[model samples]
Target: MRPLPPEALPVIVAARRTAIGTAGHAFKEVTADRLAAPVIQVVARDVACLGVPIDDVVLGNCMGPGGNLARVSALGAGLGEAVPGATVDRQCGSGLAAILMAGQAVASEEMELVIAGGAESASTAPLRAHRESPDTPYERAPFTPAGHPDPDMGAAAEALAAARGVERERQDDYAGASNAKAVAAREAGRFAAEIVEVGGRTEDQRPRLMRPASLSRLPAAFVPGGSVTAGNSSPVSDGAAVVALTSERLRAGAGLPGLRLRGGAVVGCDPALPGWGPVPAVRRLLGRTGVSMEQIAAVEIVEAFAAQTLAVTDALGLDPLGADRERVCADGGALALGHPWGATGAVVVTRLFTRLVRSGAPPGTLGLATAAVGGGLGVAALFEVV
Candidate 1:
């Protein structure tokens, strides 16, 4: 119930974002772990942890070639094997899941210091082996598809849009907002401090990491049925983010990058109608913090689907067209840059921390991240920058 400190606000000492190139392009040759190593190092390089114990490294990843990617990426980051790790699969929710876990370890006083973040290289990320039989659980269950990811994220969005009564015009409008917001942020250089340079396979036979000129002008890949399009939906991209958290007493006694963990939680909905997942998650966070929506100035919820975002807004009685949600994701969001599955949560949190750190920033700024997975699985996290 207590407030987190500025340093205790899970001080995001440093942050980085990769340019979200189109699927299978610049980052196509890179693996997820390789893509994430730089982000982890940048955040950890400046911290002094000689005697301070690192509780663990918690990571997020939605797609991988095999198993235990969190651990793989952690050790590969050169953080060492002495530190334990966890790889969470919450579909699009993985990144936020990692941040929530890191916050929990510190808030519960379970450990004083921790490394938490998420990453995803959806572009090069490989697909999983499909179920061989109708009896297979992965095939039979629904994902709000009840359990099957038959149509993938875009298809799911289309289905959700129809189910939630979201009009095509509204979906188009939402996508447009995402584009404009991101353009504003980019022009303002808001993400200058957070987006890190992510190098990947070069195009045109150049031996360098040049920002793709068409990164923003790329066309849509999912609009056949209606408003959902590649431009509006997140692209298959590569990126990562990490945070260093410590306890109140320990931080006070030392000069390390200090960040106190606030409260965090997750919830689920019927996988078939995941458009409604954020309701309980938001309610739980607000209820736990006792902070009313009116007191919160901004939000950074992951827009997995236009329907999901609209549903959460409707449930909260938030008018997307109004000023209250205006401060949300100021720089842009998944719909614009891209969604690197496991990396989105950390990316949003990293940006949220930046927003809180700047002077004259809004007060009682509440940071919340949510994601929908196959079969009604949704995860959410609420943060307060004190």
Candidate 2:
């Protein structure tokens, strides 16, 4: 892992995402390809000032049709056939993985400008069946090897909470706070710059004006007597997000010197406690970048569940339910915005972009975006406002 030349490091110039739609509602009729196409187009148009041809379009997908979906998305976005595409699938980490790969390409000078992101349309996810019995539907493939402990995500979150001593009341309170922040951000038009309309929908479909009493009343979802509840977990979602990455010269040409890719790490954790994924990933990222948590001005860790969110913060030695909690997702997170599986990793990064770039954070400020994935994986990235 040799460091890339400073001049060749990837710098994001523009980024955008479609307002997240609930799985069975706003975007039910859309496919992953369709949801992603327009966002890529918007980034391309937005970054045209760079005057550099897009060398590739890399996208992450989870349950879309089995084909070169990045190619389909590139074509659909009108990037033309000449701009080849690649797709990556690390389940929930797919989107960030794609962006990581593209950023490395730019850092290595293999490309000048690249479009990278991810999309997911759970509503349009094809019904999967085992090959042994083609007609019998299955929910998903095994995330771990046979006979190894594998728990449903909700169950894992519950176990993590129990292990970490995070109580049900705390989880419910966190969920309520997340929703309130999201509602406030929406009302203040904080997301106006990064959200693009799709299918005539202009706003995210997941943010809720939840009352604490209401959140406390929601039933547990994973296990009997468990703290993990419907109110604290991410819902089925559909959305797409993208960012334009280029070298320093190209970013300067675009006149929008977006966040610079400082360092990134993808790490594996225990399959049984998959929610702990971000712990190792973020640690590795900090180690690589030589940046301390104290210097990170903003952070967004995907909140698939409040329990996992708490566990991650505690593992990072931050106050899971205190000031650090506010620093983690000041404008809300997946708990409030909805986690569109494959697209969530990119969504967090897009959130970081808005915070550092659109919100006028000063140069040298540090931002981090991270996500825990299905199958015991985590992805984390460090960005510097440059």
Tell me each candidate's RMSD, in Å, in order.
5.6, 1.2
Q: 189-229 in candidate 1: lDDT tens per residue? A: 67667656668421111112112233334444554646565
- In model 1, where do residues sit more than 4 Å from their true spots? 1-15, 49-53, 127-151, 200-225, 252-261, 359-364
Task: State the lDDT of candidate 2 residue by residue for 7-126, as single tens digits.
Answer: 667988788999998899999999999999999999999988888789999999988988988999999999988999999999888888888999999988899999999999999999
Off by over 4 Å in 2: none
Note the clash tally of each candidate: 25, 0
TM-score of 1: 0.81
Name the top lDDT candidate: 2
Model 2 lDDT-worst window of ten: 1-10
Cα-based lDDT at residue 189, candidate 1: 69
- Which whole-number lDDT from 0 to 100 does residue 359 have in model 1? 34
TM-score list, all predictions:
0.81, 0.97
